[model samples]
Target chain A: MTTTTRGRSDITRLLLTQRIPLLAVLIVVVVVTFFINDAGGYLTASYDFDYMSGSLISAVPLAMLGLAELIVILSGRGGIDLSVGAIVSLSGMIFGFAYGQWGWPLWFAIIATVLFGGLCGAVNGVLVSYIGFPALIATLATFYAFKSIAIVINNQQPISTPPIQELYSLSKSVELPVIGASVPDVPLGIFTFLLPTVVAVWLLLARTAYGRRLYAIGTNDVAARWSGLPVRDTRFKAYVYAGLISGLVAVVTVAQFASARPDAGVSGSGMALPAITIAVLGGVAITGGIGRVAGVVLATLLIVWLNAGILLAFVGNEGSQYQLLALGTVLVFAALLNGLTTRRYGGTV
Target chain B: MTTESLNKNDKTEKNEKSPKRVRVLPAPVTGQEVVLVGVIALLWAGLALSTPAFLTAGSIQPLLVATAPIALIGVGMTIVIITGGIDVSVGGAIMVCSVLTAKTLVGSGVNLGVAVLLSVLTGGVLGLVNGVLIAYGRVHAIIITFGTANLFMFLGLQIFGSGTVNGIPGTLAFFGRGPDGRTLGVPHAFLITVLVTAAAWWYLRHTAGGRHFFAIGGDAQAARLAGVRVQRRVLLAYTTTGLLVGLASCFVIAQGTSTLDQTVGSGKELAVIAAVVIGGTSIMGGRGSVLGTLLGALLVQSVASGVTQLGWRSQLSDLFVGIFIIVAVGADLLRARARRSR
Candidate 1:
C-alpha cells in the first residue's frame, strides 16, 4: 500500500511538471470530451476525424508564431515579440507586391519575403540587444511601425490577383500518399509550412551549438558573458529567427485567405496575442530559458481542436466568444499551475 | 580669521545635510519631463505656424478631450508600472464597465453619478480579481492580466449579446466634447485628468505609502524583508488602475457618440501603455512619474491632431507614435547610460 501511494504521487508529480506529457494528456482529454459531447447529440456538427483534420489549417500560422515566440522568450531578459503579427502584415504585403504585381517567381518571392522579415527582426535585434531597449518596448514600437507601414504601403487594399488567388490551393486538404485510404486528409500547408518549420526549429534547438549558446545566455546573461559565449550575437539571431518565422507565417496566412491583406495578421485581436498565449499555455516560462518545440505544437493542437469543437457547440458568434474564454482560462490556469509546481517541486521540465 | 573659520564650518554642515535629502528623493522634475515639454511646445508652434486652424479652439478642444481618457487611465498605469506590474486588461475592463454602464443607462436611464459609480465599482471588482490572482497566486502580472483580458472581453461581448448599445442617452454629455463638457474654455475631461494627475503626483512623492510602491518594484524580496506589505501594495496598484480605468471609461463614453460599438475598448490598453512609457515611466518599475505620462498623452494627441490637420493619412499618426516611443525611450536609455558612467 505504501509503495502504491508513493508511485501514484510520483506520477502526479510527473504530469504536473513535465509540460509536454501534460499537454499530451490535456489534448487527449479535450478531444475525448468533444467526442463525448458529439455522441450525446450536443454538437451541431459531427466532431469527427475529418473535422479535426480540417481544423489543422488554422494551426499552421498559430503554431508557427508560437514557435517564433518560443525562440524569443527562451532568450530571456524579458524577451517578447509583440510585433510578429505586424511583421506578418507588412511582410505579406511585400510578398503581394512582389509576386502579385511584379510577377516574381514563387520561390524567389517567398525567399524575399522571409529575408525582409528577418531584416525587420534585425531592427528589433539592434534596438534590444545592441542599443539596450527592453524587448517589450522595442517590439511594441516595431509593431506600430510595421502595422502602419503595411496599411499605408498598399493604401489599405488587399491583393488578390489571379496568381495570389491560385495560392489558395496550397491550404487545401491533401491525403497521405501511401496511407491515403486509411485516414482523413490533412491540410497541405501543414506539411509544406508548419511541419518543416517545427522540425527545423527542433533540430536547431536540440542539435546545434548555437542553440546551446542561446539557452546558456537566456539562463543567465552575465554568466553566459563570463563563460565567453557570444551572448549578444546569439540573442540577436533569436529575434531574427522569430522574424523569419513570422514572415513565413505571413505567406501561409496570405494563402489561407486567398489574398495578401494589409491587416492579415493584425485584424481583430491580432495574431501576436494568441501566439503568445499558446506559447505561455505550452509551459514556456515568460522568464525564458525553458521551453520545447513539442510543447508548443501540442498546445496549438489543443487550442485548435478545442476551438473547432466550440464552433460546433455554440451557435453564431457565441462560439468565437467562448473561444476567448477558453483561451483566457487555460492561460491563467497554466500560469498558476506553473507557479504551484515551482513551489511544490522545483520547476517544470 | 575667527569669522572665516566659523562660516566654513557652517557651509560644510549644510552641504552634508543636503546630499542626504537629495539622495532620498528623485528630482522633482526629471530631465525627460523637461525635454517633453520642449518637444510639445515645438510641435505646437510648428503646427500653429503651418496650419492656421491647428491652434483654433475647434481643434484644440477635441484634442484635449481625446487625450483625457488615455491620460486618466495612464495615471493608474503609472502606478502599476511603478510596482513592476502591468495590467493589459484595462482595455477589457473598459469594455465591461462601459458596456455595463451603457446598458444600465439604456435600460434604466440612471443619473450621471450612478452611472459613474456603477462603472467604477465594476472596474474595481475586475481589478480586485487581477490583484488577488497576481498577489496571492504569485503569478507574473502580465500572464494573469492577459488571461483576464480575455475573460473580461468575453464578459463584455456577452453583455452586448448581439450588437452595439444604440440610442444611449446623453446623460454623459457633461464629460463629452459638447459645449457643456467645457468650463471657461477648458474641457471637463482634460481638467479632471489634470487634477487626478496632480493628486497622484503628490501621493507618489510626498507619502510613505507611495514610496512603498517604489520599494516593492525596486526589489520585492528586499521590500518584504524591510517590513513593507509587498503583496498588498501590488494588489493596491492593480485595484487603483481598475478604479481609474472605470473612470476613464466614462470619459470614453462621453467623448463618443450615442452608439457604443463592440470596438469601444479594444486596443486602448496599448494606447494607455504607450502614453505611460512615452511619459518617461520606466517599464522595469521602481521609477516613474505621472506628470510625464500626462505630458506624453498630450504630445501623442497633439501629433494625431496635427497629422489630420495637415491632410496626412490618419494611419500615418501611428508611425509617428512609434517613432516618438523609440525616441523617448531611447533618450531615457542614453541618459541612464550617461548617469551610470558619471
Candidate 2:
C-alpha cells in the first residue's frame, strides 16, 4: 500500500514538473500563431478552434490505435500489432464495400468490420501465445500477409459510396455563436464524436477488473500467468480489442467520408508503430504497464497542435512529407528526453 | 560460423538430444530462392535465343546497372538481419547519401574518392543514430529507423530538390563505368557485388564480432552476459549497414547519372528483407549466412525480373513474396518444433 502511494505521488510529481513545459509550449504556439497570422486570426480565432478540432479528429483513429496497442504492450508478453494498418485498410475496405455494394446497414457494417479485425488479431495472438512464434516475426508476417490480402480482395480499388449525410453528421456537429448569437461557444469533434469513444474506453480500461490484470501482465507476464491470470486470453483480448476498435473506426471513417479508399491507412511502417510513439509521448512506458488515459489525450492534442502549427507556419517544403518528418523528429526528441530523464532518476528509459 | 561446427551440430541429432543439433545443420536454400535464380538464368538464355538484341553486349548492361544498389544494399541487410535487427531506413540512408554525393560534386566539388568517403561516413553516422536508439532506448529498431528514415528522406528532399542535378547529374560515373564488353562480359555492378560478397563472407567467418552477431540474434541476454559489448556491436552492425547503403547510393548515381525522388528507397527494405528470408535467413534472427543472403537477393530479384519478362502484373510480386515469406517461416517453425519434440 505504501509502495503504491509512493509510486502514485512520484508519477504525480513528475507530471507536475513536466506539465509546465508542455503547457508553456502550447501557450507560446497559440500566441505566436495568433499574432503572426493576425489578419484578425484571433487573440485566437474560432478557425483556430476548428483547426485544433480537425487535428483531434485526425488523432482519434490514432488514439484507438494507441489504446489498442497500449493494452497489448501492458500485458507484458511483449507483443506489437505490426499488421494494424493493414488491418485498418482491410477492415475499412470491406465495411465500405459491403455497405456501398451490398447495402448493409451501418451497425451491421460496424459489427462485421470489428469482427474481422478481431479474427485477424486472434490469429496473431494464437501464433504467439500457442504456436510459440516470435512476436516480431509473426506480426511482421501478418503485416505483409494482411496487406496483400486487402490488396487482392479490393484490387487496390477505393470503396466509395453515395453520401450518408445523417451518419456523417454524427461525427460532424458544431455549435457556433458567431460574433454574439444564441450559442455560448464553439464546438469540436471530440465533444460530438470521440468523447463517447473515449468515455467508453476509459470505463473499459479503468473500471474493470480485467483492466487491473491487463496492467499486471504488462508489468510481468510470467508472474501474472503464474498468479493464475489468463495471460493467453487477456493477450488475445488485447489484440481482439485493438482489431475491433480498428474495425469500428474504419466504419466510422467510411460513414463520415461516405467512401472507403483502399489506401485509407496503407503506410509501410503501420499505424500501430506510430500510435506507439504517440502513446509513449503521451506517457505510456515503452516497456509497458504504466500509463494514463489523460496523458494519452494530452499527447494526442499536442500532436494535433504541432501538425496544425506546421501547416500554418509553412516552414519547409509544401509536400507535407515534411510534416511526417517533423512528427518523427518530435517522437525521437521525446524519446531522447525520456532517456535523459530516466538516467537522471537512475531509471532506464 | 563453420561447416565443421555445422556437421558436429548435426551429429548431436540424437532422439533425446536438444534440438540444438538442427540449429547447426545447414539450411538448404529454398525453392523460392533456387527457382528465382534459375528463372533469372533461364530468362537470360531465352532472351538471348529469342532476340538477337538480347545478346548484344549492351543488353545485359541495364540489368546489371539496376542490380548495383540492390546488391550493395543486400550486403548491409545481410549483416543487420544476422544480428536480428531490421534497418528499413537503408533506402532513406542511401537517398541522403545520393544527394550528399551530388552536393559534394556541386557545392564542395571534392574529388571522387573523398566524396565517396564522405558519403559513406554520413551513412555510418545515420546508422549509428539508429543503433543508439534501438539498443539503448529499447525502442523497436523499426520505429527508430522509421523516424530516422523520415528524417533522412526529408533532409535529402530539402538538400537536393526533386530535380535531377542538371547536366552534371550528380552521379559518380567512375566506379560504375565498364570497359567495352571486357572483364568477362560482366557489368561493373556485377563485379562489385561479387567482390563485396567475397569480403562479406570473409568478414562474417573471420571476425569475432561477426560471430557475436549470430550470438546476439540467438539470444540477446545470453550474448550480453557472455561478455559481449552487445550495444557497441549492434551499433557497429548498423553502421556497417549504413556504409553499405551509402556505397549503394554512390554507385546508383555512378551507374545511372540520375537523381531519385524522395520516395526512391522508401519501401525497398521490404524486398531486401523478403530476399534475405527467402534465401534462408530466419526472420526470428540469429541464423543467416553471407552466401544465403546472396542467394536470397538473387531469388527476390529473379521474381521481379522473371515476372517482367513473362509479362505478369508486377504488383502481384507482393503477393508472391508474401506467400513465400509465410511458407518459409512456417516451415522453419515446423522444423524447429519437430526437432524439439524429437
**Residues B1-342 of candidate 1: C-alpha lDDT, one tens digit per residue:** 112322354566588855543234677998899999999999999999999888889999999999999999999999999989998999999999999999999999999999999999999999999999999999988889999999999999999999999999999998999999999989999999999999999999767788888878787887787778989998999999999889999998998899899998888898899999999999999889999999999999999899889998888888998999999999999999998999
Off by over 4 Å in 2: A1-13, A16-47, A164-173, A176-193, A255-258, A267-272, A315-322, A340-349, B1-71, B102-115, B132-143, B162-183, B218-227, B251-259, B282-285, B307-311
lDDT of each: 0.93, 0.68
Q: Per-residue CA lDDT of candidate 2, range A56-118, in tens?
A: 567767777777766666655456666677778788878876777788886786778889888
Fnat of each candidate: 0.70, 0.33
Relative to the unseen true structure, what is the C-alpha lDDT of residue B260 in candidate 2, on a scale of 0 to 100?
Answer: 46
Show the lowest summed lDDT stretch of 10 residues, model 1 chain A.
A210-219
Pick out the ten consecutive residues of candidate 2 chain B with the lowest summed lDDT.
Answer: B1-10
TM-score of chain B of 1: 0.94
Model 2 Cα lDDT, one tens digit per residue, B274-311: 66776667665687766656665654564555555566
Interface RMSD of each: 0.6, 2.9
Model 1 fnat value = 0.70
Model 2: residue B136 alpha-carbon error in angstroms: 6.0
CAPRI rating of model 1: medium
